[model samples]
Target chain A: MTATAFQFDDVTFAYRTQRALEGVSLTIRSGERVALLGANGSGKSTLLRMMDALCFPASGTATAFAAPLTEAAFQDDATNYAFRRRVGLVFQNPDVQLFNPTVSDELAFGPLQLGWEKPKVRDAVDTVSARFGIAHLKDRPPHRLSGGEKKRVALASVLITEPDVLLLDEPTAALDPASRANLVGFLAREPGAGRTVVTATHDLDIVEDIADRAIVLAEGRVVADGPVLAVLHDVDLLRRTHLVFEHRHSHGGPPAGSHGHMHSSRQEG
Target chain B: MADQRYGICGCGRGRRGALDSLVLGLVNAEAYALDAEATATRPGFLQSVDPRIKVLALVALIVATTATRSLVVLAALFVAAVALALISRIGPGRLARQVWVGVLIFSGIIVLPAIFLVPGTPIVHLPVVGWAITLQGLRSAAFVVGRAETAATLALLIVLTTPWPHVLKALASLGVPAAAVAVLGMTYRYVFVLIEAARHMMEARRSRIVAPLDGRERRRMLMTAIGMLLAKTFALGSDVHAAMIARGYRGEVRLLHDFHTRPPDWVFLAIALAVPALILGLQP
Candidate 1:
């Protein structure tokens, strides 16, 4: 069996009077690409935040790399730094995540915080900016950029740190079709060595291309866990979990006189 | 449209005017952002100078201007600032709009009362108020306005020439407190976002208005929006802080502000610093 990269054993958490997650026990193996599929407020984002140790569980233990995840564990600056360096979280909103004025500074922020020398930090920023195709936006303010450009800068800001575990919350939300395709293609091609990519998203079309395994959450509980194709193809399960709505529609058939016809069917509204 | 009694005017027209002014506010905010970008991108002398040197040189000039009580010296500094602004491709019109309107006019108003209030030799008697203006008072008022104008021009020049990031980085390098610098950077970046968000909220509210709101009703709606915005801001602040912490940012904000000073930068700094000293030295 693959070594467990993250283990959440009966972890429960609440926000004020609302319970966000309940008995969320899950074990993710190293280098596993997991898709956290759920409806809004289904605790997908909360789960990812827990994995990054940004939030603590009210009950049970959340462990990453065999170390217990807790506020006390991160009380030590070095331990917190190491944990942060290993796990990078790309926020859903680029506006909040991108606090730096310029794109270059945004990317260099993490490396600089890690105490890398000036030259090394500059090189890392340059390399990452180039890879993200934001070399032209190096001096441009992040807030002034277009939505897609801002998203790229936000992702580059996190990826420049070269974290081992990449946790993204709704990574494709608010992106144009082309930018969305570009991001999906990038994630599919460059999962990177020894890095685990867990994306919380409702965009099921790219799940097959980006994630191998799927974890479906419904009302703060794991509804299903299986291969991406199996979970996504099971329309009944998807509808029951509220990951996808039951739409009654069909493309009817292929072009006239074609060799084969095409059609799709599902539950009624 | 209902007749809304505004604080300024008691009529429905006042409500319409308020809506128009709200739109204008967004335009004004955008224009400031545009000016900052335009001045930084302009091809000019100060645009190419190193920001660290630029900051220190301009600050030195301000200090020199404030220390010298000589009108002649202050006038010379003001002229020098205007000349620098012209050479830096920042239009005289733009400078007039920003510095003259923003600083000089306000300073002039404040100093106007001083001319009549201060005890000095009578120069000219005002026709309306029947108050004699004193030479000592006039000189003192001119000195105050001149010093403020020169300092404001030089400060605006630095901001107009240098990109905001470099300016903040220079401040950080020049021994500004780390926490203070961090706040400065965050404010510079997020303040615009907040403004844009508020603008959008206003636009949405305006669009949804089926009928004009009375003064009290408008105030209530505005209060609700403001309260919601504040609540959102608090939540967003926490989220942003969390995002920063998740990326290994532990209080100290370290940035890679790379600056290379050519020989010209030193020459410019020397000239900039010397002019102020020369002006002060030639003072009586």
Candidate 2:
């Protein structure tokens, strides 16, 4: 078997008095595009953050790249830097991820933090920004860009770092249809080599294009883990996990073809 | 999407009543957007210079403009600032409008009362009881207004000519604490985000309004909107901090390029610094 990129050994975590994750154990192999499918507050985001070493497991062990992640590991400067450089986590809200004034600066932020020299940082930023189609927004401030543009910049900022693993939290939460399709197309493109992509989203429509594998979470527990098509096609399981609900599309048209299916529903805690 | 239950707008008659504030908000938004975009796009005199030099030189000029007590020097500095604005291709009209609205008129209003209050030879008698414009008071008021105009013009010139990121980078390189610069950068970035969020909240409220609100009712709703916006800002701030940390920000903010001073930068710096000194030295 391929080396595990991320291995969670029965991890459990909580915030204040509430439990966020409980006895969640899973293994992600290298180069695998895996989707953490779950409703809101289902611990998908917390799990992704743990893999990036942004948060440590409360009880069990979470390991990345063969090393067990720990509070002490992140306390060490070299280890913390290396861990952060290796794994990138994109926040759900573009406003939170994009804190730089201009798109160029936002894309340049991570590489510069990694202590890349001026020319290298600039080159990386240019390449990634161009790839993400944000070259026109180079000097534009993040706050001024439309929602789609900001999301593109946010993703570009993380991708510019050239991390080995990418952890995306609800990457398409607040996007319009055009932007959503654009992102799906970008994510579907194969990056030449070994790069693991783990997306924490319950967006079923994107699963087939973005990821081959699906790990479904419900109420802080893994209810299903299998191929994307098999898991998402299981309407009963999806309904039981509260990932989709029955909705009648009565306003748009007279019974349209294939429009009879239920739409995905995002649960709120 | 909320249904448009009214004609010509998402809100009915309520939209007309809110038109004044809406127009004001749009103007402020456009002003900020134009200020950020116009300077960065134009290839002009000040835009080419190093941001560090521009910031330092303009700041020095502001200080000198305020320090000199001579009305001639202040007027000379104001004239010089206008000349530079023309050369820099920053719309002279725009700069004048900003200074007139933000500084000149404000100073004019504040100094108006002083013109009648200070004791001196009465130049003109007003229709008001026991009030006359004094020559000394007028001269002193002119001094106050002139100083203010000069200082404000120079400050606005700097902001209007330089990109905000470059300006922040220059500040950071100039020994401003990294943490403070980071905070300033975040605040600058998110201020617009907060404004946009607040606007969305207001729009949502407007969509839900079934009837026109009286002034008191509108004020209460505005207070609630402000409270919610503050709460959202707090939560957003934490999330942004976490995202920063995840991306390897360890207190110190690192940028792609360091400030490099070219020969032109130095020459520009020299002229900028020398103008104020010459004005001060040549004072009669």
- Which numbered prediction scores highest in TM-score against the true structure? 1
Angstrom error of the Cα, residue A250, model 2: value is: 9.3
Each candidate's DockQ score against the native complex?
0.76, 0.74
Clashing pairs in 2: none
Off by over 4 Å in 2: A245-269, B1-27, B90-92, B113-134, B214-219, B258-264, B279-284
Give the per-residue lDDT digits (tens) of candidate 2, residues B1-284: 12232222543544454533653465476567666567665888887889899998888788778778777777888888888788888667787676756787789989999999999999999885868999999998998998888888888777878877888888888888877888888887887777667656756775687766788887787677767877999999888888988899887888654567899888878877886687678766
Residue range with the least summed lDDT across 10 consecutive positions in model 2 chain A: A260-269
- Please state how well chain A of candidate 1 matches the true chain A, as a TM-score: 0.91
Tens digits of per-residue lDDT for model 2, A1-269: 78889998899989878898999999999999999999888999988888877778889988898888999887888888888888998898998999987888888888888788889888887798778888999988887788899888888899888888988999888888899889888888934368899999988888888899999998888989999999989999998988888765555556663354577863221
Full-model lDDT for every candidate: 0.84, 0.82
Alpha carbon lDDT at B42, candidate 1: 84
Best by DockQ: 1
- TM-score (chain B only), all candidates: 0.89, 0.85
State the displacement of the C-alpha of residue A245, model 2, in Å, after optimal TM-score superposition. Answer: 4.2
